[model samples]
Target chain A: MNTFTLGLVVVIYLLLTAYLGYVGFRQTKTSEDYLLGGRTTHPFIMAISYGAAFISTSAIVGFGGVAAVYGMGLIWLTFLNILFGIFIAFIVFGRRTRRLGRRLNAHTFPEFMGKRFGSRGIQTFIAAVIFIAMPLYAAVVLIGGARFIESIFAIDFNVALTFFTVIIAAYVIAGGLKGMMYIDALQGGIMFLCMLFILVMTYVKLGGVMGAHQALENMAELVPEGLRMKGHQGWTSYPAWGSEWWWTLTTGIILGVGIGALAQPQLVVRFMTVKSGRELNRAVLVGGIFILVVTGFIYTAGALSNVFFHRQTGQLAIEAAGGNVDRIIPLFLNSAMPAWFVYLFMLALLSAAMSTLSSQFHTMGSALGHDLLGTLFPKTRTNGMVITRLAVIFGIVVSMVIGYKLPGGIVARGTAIFFGVCAAAFLPAYIGGLFWPRTTATAVKWSIATGIVASLFMLVFMHGSESAPLGICKALFGRDVLVEQFPWMLVDPIIIALPLAGAVLIAVSLLTKHESALDV
Target chain B: MFGINSCGIWLGYLLAVLSVLLCVWYGAKKWNKDDDSAADDNWDSAETQLNENL
Candidate 1:
């Protein structure tokens, strides 16, 4: 597509998002309106908003790139995304969360946790963790969208990042959750259409399924001796059973992203926007179908792109785009897609990036403005609107700086780090508070504290490249750090930390007696 | 691009199975008309007590 047409499509989409923000600004009269859409969002809008926020450019770019490298095994992640992320998330978690949120009269995720458990301290601590950790994820998402724009349009990387940051921040700060949801619904629609078109076009370009597979199968015979030895025989087959690659595929990509959806604060807060359980139930199908298409199409096309690119060039798309796997989707779209589809695809990419970014910035700003500081100084009584707007600006600035400094793929990994932390810190408390009658404030606090401490210690001292310099894990364990030496450490912290946190919650609640001294 | 690949066919079948299961679950939950005498008894007695009081 010509630069002018592509830019025009993006500009029109931005204007539509801004118009939605304007509508939200007029409708919003109270802090509750700003935070939870006046507790009256419709099922369709709610479902799309939740789905859009749940699947960002990270899914399309980062994981798609990973698929280009790893092959069709990543499709399991897509299946789990629908079954767990959408289906179970909406029916099991969404209904209960909406009911409890309404009962507690909570606006934000931290507020919901705090009010449900009757602990101001728990709320503040969760807000603190969110504010501290979420920027990493937000920055990674920013990188994914900006990198795509830079690759397609040849714009400067920092310029693209800054433009995206400002556009998202404006709508979220001005319009709030209602505006975010409206734009999300629109973005969600565009994303669905774009994915469907890309998939069909890719199939047609490859001359149908049988022809394409035969070509890929023939090409598989030419796999480099080195890659064949490493177990990459072809892009046509699943990885060998019980291989190290298979484990990473199943655990890290599939289970990690799928299970991590349960504890995402930005997504959970969407449940609080609707009026009743019935509304959430109605949204279940809409949400599931949306995820089934967006995620399913993305993964299917990503896997198929292997054949198209490999047949044309001797290398996988990821290698064709240098060593950076995240660039594969953008490279394929720019080079292989029809010119007009490229224009539409830009809108899809914009929708994915902006929808998720607005929600992240809103969630981060609220966590900082409402929960953390509001708890420490009970008498402040500042207007939430003003405070939230300022916090949005603060969040945008911090995320942009991080986006500028970090490499694209590293930013993607950083997003996984935050999701893991949220699962560790909040999942037990969230699940227990909803189901267990005897869950206490003390247990909630202890569980959160332990989960946060363990995850942070591991992330800093064990997971990344600078592990040796940090060395907190080494100091504690008298070792070179288990995560670096063992592949299992890469994906094992959540298994250990989540159970430990849950055990603390259960044991502590059982051990301590209530202050009222009432019979159980 | 793998047009008639078995992988594609398997994926299609998997999706079809998923859709059918979802339909069956929703249909059974929404349309099932089995009687529950114990719950009915509780409701009948409660109605009777209210009528007597009136």
Candidate 2:
């Protein structure tokens, strides 16, 4: 817990991280190895790496703090993370994606989609969307990491942001996917062990598991007056079914991340990194368990932070975190965790943040260099690795700008917004492209455009949380929302746009002449 | 009908447990099955089969 000990531990972590990067760099001679680890990665490594990349500091620092405010209802998001994110992602999608990636020799998400549909336009459009939209997701991830570093290290925010960003960028740019996955496996292990300790220790800090829930139930009246007006029952409870808070929790967080997990271009491409359907099949249980433990423990511990805060400061966790929901987990650790564990958990949180950031940066770089620039200038194919490394630097700089400018409490919202947009924009075409041979490339184009337009319109005009600032109505009419109608502003864009995206894909596919499913 | 109370939160926990169970059940079945149909025996040959034979 002392400076000397903390310094020593961090050095050890850095040494190990560098060793993995070195091994990855050495083994990665060709572009293929850099991108997919020669397609021979161990299943356990793949599973843990997948889970770690999928659940980052956003789950821990950002959304965990929201758990402090919203209570156990956030657990459904965990359920969705496992059921949809891990279960279906690996079992349903991973098998076919791996098979097809080998079939078509596609290395990136846009490449995979473009090759699947046999459309250069589809590939270019996807590449452009990912290059543009992915940075926002990456920025929120960067912010989540920087926030934890800033809070715990007691450093200036910008300094912490730079420190974390530079560290992650060094390895990701140098070692590529091989380095990222190897590092992810290590970080995933640290996260698993630390979360297990946090769960047990938090219950001890409270009276016991059952007793903690009781104490929380007894403090229902302590729910913030604002949240209570919105239908909060207690720190241990869900909101009333149809309340404003319920809609936000259910539609925004749960559905946004739950169903939205399926369409994430980063996660989707992870399916292709393995050699065989058997490897992906073997990874399902390991990935599910990893996701369940990491997400389950964090959500549970985050909800219990309220009880811990009340015992410590006679205040709710959100209030004690100084009004930023993102700060709740960091502040709670400082107050509740043992001193030695505090330093150790710093590494765990770093693992949570860095593992995710590395993957996001990798995805952004691939989207830019391999998908966009590579698509534009096919002659630069020989310089693929150099182009990707350059894009990684660009992605990091763009991420740092947003990390600095983004308002507080936007971490979780930013993550969900991107996820929801992807669900609406990419999910329908992705699903149809995988399953239905009748899915025409032209139909998928319409689906993608519809998804992007509809989701953005709803987010800007109808969704209450984000609509205030960027909504069309606010911009045009100087009013809050386009419609003064009831509950129109209450629902998140995923609910509105996802169905429309799916419908468009179906309608266009049904009317069009089909090609061979494997024509690509 | 739903309230953020002890029972509701516990219900979420129960659902999470059920999901893990379902995942395990499905994963166990998938693991036990033989996937020889998609084995990575011959890399370029597999690509050729996929491109034309399939």
Best by DockQ: 2
Give the least accurate 10-residue stretch of model 2 chain A, judged by summed lDDT: A511-520
Among all candidates shown, the one with the greatest lDDT = 2
Question: lDDT for model 2, on a 0 to 1 scale?
Answer: 0.83
Q: lDDT tens string, model 2, A1-520?
A: 3778887888899889988988777777766776777787888889999888888777877777778888878888888888889878887788878877877788888888899988878988998898788888888878877876776667898999998898899889888888889998999999998888888999898888778877777888887789988979886778887888888888888888889989888888788888777677778878877877888887888888988888878888988877877678878887888888878788888898888888888888888888888888997779988888898899889988988998866777788888888999999999888888889988898999999999888877777777886656777878877776756788889999999999999999899888534642
- Over all chains combined, what TM-score does candidate 1 have? 0.87
Candidate 2 CAPRI grade: acceptable
Fnat of candidates, each listed: 0.09, 0.50
Candidate 1 segments whose C-alpha is farther than 4 A from its true place: A210-233, A461-480, A483-486, A514-520, B1-54
Separately for all candidates shown, the number of backbone clashes (residues 3 or more apart, or on different chains) is 5, 4
Clashing pairs in 2: A237-B4, A237-B5, A238-B4, A460-A471
Can you write out model 1's per-residue Cα lDDT over B3-26, one digit (the tens) per residue? 334463357437534953563354
lDDT of 2 at B30: 77
What TM-score does candidate 2 get on C-alpha atoms? 0.93
The residue pairs that clash in candidate 1, if any, are A208-B3, A209-B2, A209-B3, A209-B4, A210-B4
